[model samples]
Target chain A: MANSKRTLAALVYNRPGVLNRVASLFRRRGFNIESIAVGRTDDPKLSRMTIVVIGDNATVEQVRKQLDKIVDVVKIIDITGDDMVSRELALVRVKATTATRAEIVQMVNIFRGAIIDVGSNTLVIEVTGDEDKIDSLLNLLRSYGIREVARTGRVAMTRGGTIGSIKAEEEAATGRQR
Target chain B: MKLSGARMLCQALINEGVDVIFGFPGGSVLPLYDVLPEFQGLRHILVRHEQGAAHAADGYARATGKVGVCLATSGPGATNLVTGIANAHLDSSPVVAITGQVARAFIGKDAFQEVDITGITLPITKHNYLIMNASDIGSVVKEAFHLARTGRPGPVLLDIPRDVFVEEAEFNYPDKVELTGYKPIHQGHPAQIKRAAELINSSECPVIIAGRGIIISDACEQLRELVEKSQIPVATTLLGMGGFPGTHVLSLGMLGMHGTAYANMAIQNSDLVICLGSRFDDRATGKVSAFAPAAKIVHVDIDAAEIGKNVRVDVPIVGDLKVVLQVLNTLVNSKSRPAWLEQIQKYQREHPLCVSSEEDKLLPQHVISQIYELTGGDATIVTGVGQNQMWCAQHFLYTRPKTLISSGGLGTMGFELPAAIGAKVGCPKETVWCIAGDGGFQMTMQELATAVQDKVAVKIAILNNGYLGMVRQWQELFYDKRYVGTPLWSPDFVKIAEAYGIPACRVKNKKDVSAAITTALSYDGSYLIDFMVEPEENVYPMVPPGASLAELMEHPDARRANASSTFTVSNV
Candidate 1:
């Protein structure tokens, strides 16, 4: 099978060097991480990571199994083709002059974005949507001399259902560890 | 009761059933040494170097099937243990290494004698931790040992800061580990095992590649039963030497690079390959694509990632080898395969692994065979990597499990002597022999002092070839015999051994091998023998780099005079 884009979600314990362990695993396994976004989940003790990588099924499977080998990683699931909603937030500080200020505001409004900061020389625009929507908004604002852009890589969650690991956790309690 | 972290660490180890610890003290670990006298059950062996301590712990673990413990201070002491730790990790030896870190406040502040040992060993260790609080020491120690000894065993490390050792804390050792992702599969799925049994019953030509997992899992008897019941020819990987009885009728010795010709032949011809607890290393499976082309593989391993990591398999049984094999034994039928056994015997007769006798020259193989004959093939034989290692693997007929211990994966050179010392320390009643190359022996020969000091009565046999023999063989065969930095200069090994207060001898003739080995075997204390064997002698039945198992290069003497021109002899 040909290679395709993959997004994998993992629940991990929030501990020191957990990020380093995950990053080091990918580095040593020769797998490239396209984008990875990690933040605290509903539980304070757990962190959720949505990682986007590109590989075939076998390679992705291998990546998943190897990633699961990390002692800090609680559970992992491939959420690529699943019914999940993913969005990225990007803060673009565009160089807006007197003439281009109104034009940039109009472009942000058209992309369904908001101007969080209005500086004398630049406008800081915060956009949150799918990758394509963010990219399209960035393209229009790029001609206005964007000063800086910082993006939180894709964070995803399945829609309208619970794709959870209650069963795996229960199995672990009974010593069904893999 | 409130106790210091150092005392709690000792208590945790005692609770975990650790008998001995190999370690070296430095500035940061002074508190550990200060509190060591309070621990009555733990016997500490003071090694000459931190590397020796690590290897010794590894050897102890390999011999006893328990977690080996090593201790060292911060900075250089911790760095010195890298090679040995890597050796244990690659070979899946159960070891827990504890290193002292700089004080918690001084950490990341360029403190004196400070280094990130945990970060440095992260890749090599199964798991590692840098505990900031003294309260976490007991729990971390328990966790480290549990991780090191259970489920596809490997080395685990804990780096505790200097302050934590003397700082007082309530020591509450956790009875059970609480890692959600750290569980290992113990029982194989029943359906998968049944399918594997079905594959075994159906296949005509089957080979069992018994690996180190057999010895690690203590399933040698089960493996033998399975092999006999299924009537499959069993071949061992180098590390798997003693896992299957070498003298058994169904045994095809070792298979892979420098493997026995008959074993390699059997593997290439077999229609089914049932791998137990052994990863398909490149050395074992010459060219991955050409490895067992006609065989439908049934791989059984505790780690799930290992099943299809190296080669594709038909039935993948991911679980503990012992549990899997017990169920498999019940399912497999007792059968007879006269034709397959006859074919293997034919290969054995045609290309037997042997050295041609020379009246004057002392052959390494001859020395090894002599040792095997003298010791009754029961000694725990440990070896350094290279030609000496292969010769020991081929010549020593191991009839017991965990009898042959070598650094299989990392191929660490200075592993034998220290590991032998450790094995002797762990199994005091068993006769232990250290087979080292002269070059490798020089790397950590200082550990002979440790052996003498600790009264680890292990006999040392140095195959003094005066060169890194394996690299020389590779250069001769593939690098056009350039011999760049291969030749070695050495001191008088006998004198060196005598300087360390060890009984020593040198052998230059083949006739004296018997007496030398017999003397070493019977001697009460640690002895050393420098066998000046024929240099430039290459290990035979070698699969050259990038070649398939079928393209094996036979030794000049192994190729019979009137045999068909089927074997290729390297022009060395």
Candidate 2:
């Protein structure tokens, strides 16, 4: 019963208070959410939400079932064990002087990140990758005194399989859809 | 033709076959009330409080299996319905609550009598809507009804601002709703059903824990068929009491805390547990990990979320109860359970469900049984929370669906009076009985006025225990008998009932209980009786908190009389 990171993508009716309904359900049912992100899907009436939570497989399966119970949630796809592509966007600002700026720039280059903002004493770097690469860059900048950071929780889609199909949702709990 | 928002909403209700509603009128909902006279087909009962309106609507829904309707004004009015809505939500009753909000322009400015009712009811409701425009009135009402009655029925709410009620709009009610996300699975997967049948066929000792889903799905006939065909004994949850006939040879009365000893033992010894339509609520499954440890659970429910929420299921089937049972019946092999049934009969004989009778004092069980005997087990019985609720559940033999309507899940006190009123209103030809405890009776006794005003003819029986008996029992058993706030001080219930213009009487002795019940049952209008009973009586065969069903505390009298009974001192 080891806790593992689970990524779930939900297609939901784009309506007022829909996000609140989904989030409130997770909190009320005693499920801890690690991170979550929301954006409009290709369908105008539907929105795609990527949710990251940490729990054992059974508990996460219960989570997927409960989330699917929401009337506004059109579908749920758990890509945790699937062959999937995932990325996270993070904006990190590290405290900097002229002496530390070039070293920070080199670290950003190695991580393939861009300097999004620059202040007299702070350098804001933007990175987009899986959670690990961003964590690596942030860990590297911690010694230079990281000032502010905002991380969009990871969003995921399966590698080549059809997502959101009836078969996919049915097999999510079984962990054999892909 | 164009119609005001109020007219459109009323028309939609009429089109949906709603003939009656329970409500209280106030400032913000004046426009809605103003148009009530035009709709002569609609009848509204004026309730004493918004809470009573909600409970009445719930009672109506449970008794009739239709969507119960309740309406209230803004702020306090809307908040008052919270408990009733939550009660319906937990019990999975179909209810639609309509609340009027402050004028659109006045919202969010701390306007008088304004509150964020939709937000307040969000978690408690299946779904809720806030009517921002007048044109959306018909569809919102349509969708609210659709959601409330379908897909594991629950309470739904529609909060309309005052301006929306008066604004004129062309009204066209939709005949269909297109909710892609809300399709409730009705048919069980064929393979899963076959697997469940194989599990059942392989088991030597099996127990079918029938739940409210059977009644809600109108699958009691199918349940009877399955039980008779499969030769499986049935134990029920509190709300599932009537799903299987209490007098059936296969029936093990309600299981869990305050359940029959035989039922709990049967479950503890079961090899296979087939749960239908009922969620594995904590009350039903004591010490979850230890509950039915030897059994492989096959859970059949309409909601997928309920399958593994409490106990993990081996063969999980999500479908409507009737639809599932119909298909399940054809697959389960016919078997003889002579050994299992004989073993259960031995358990019943050793630990029979009985009440300690007294020649001088009236017990709560005596009052309930007399009502059962007098009504011939044909009344729609409603109960408030606590000891009276348990006694009524135990003493009365419910053989039909929709006959026992009580607040099961939320355990709300004072649900008895208003819900009985609602049940009486919905089924006027049937006898309705409201059995309440003194502590719970005093909570919403004001609804006595509503009962009299509406001429509902509901018979009221108050088990006057002088204290919150259930808490007192717990305190006596677990807290060294230090009676704190459990003792209640209240006025004479007979006088209170008289003030409401209902014929009332008080019964203090066991002999007087029968005549009082007889008088109430035959009375043309509503009647009330306050039966002063033994205050310290406790509901026995209790599965102690966090104790498995195998560990039960038998009756005190039995423990004192029988030296060899399994009464554990650790619970004390």
Summed over model 2, clashes come to 0
Backbone clashes in model 1, listed as residue pairs: none
Question: How do all models score by TM-score?
Answer: 0.96, 0.95
Per-residue lDDT for A5-93 in model 2, tens only?
Answer: 89988888788999888998788768788999998754567778889998888888887887787778878878899888999999998
Off by over 4 Å in 2: A30-32, A95-100, A118-122, A161-163, A166-178, B559-572
Per-residue accuracy of model 1 over B194-278 as CA lDDT, tens digit each: 9999988888899999999999888998998999888999999988988988888888888999898889999999999999989
Colliding pairs, model 2? none
Clashes per model (N, Cα, C within 3 A): 0, 0
Comparing only chain A of model 1 with the true chain A, what is the TM-score?
A: 0.90
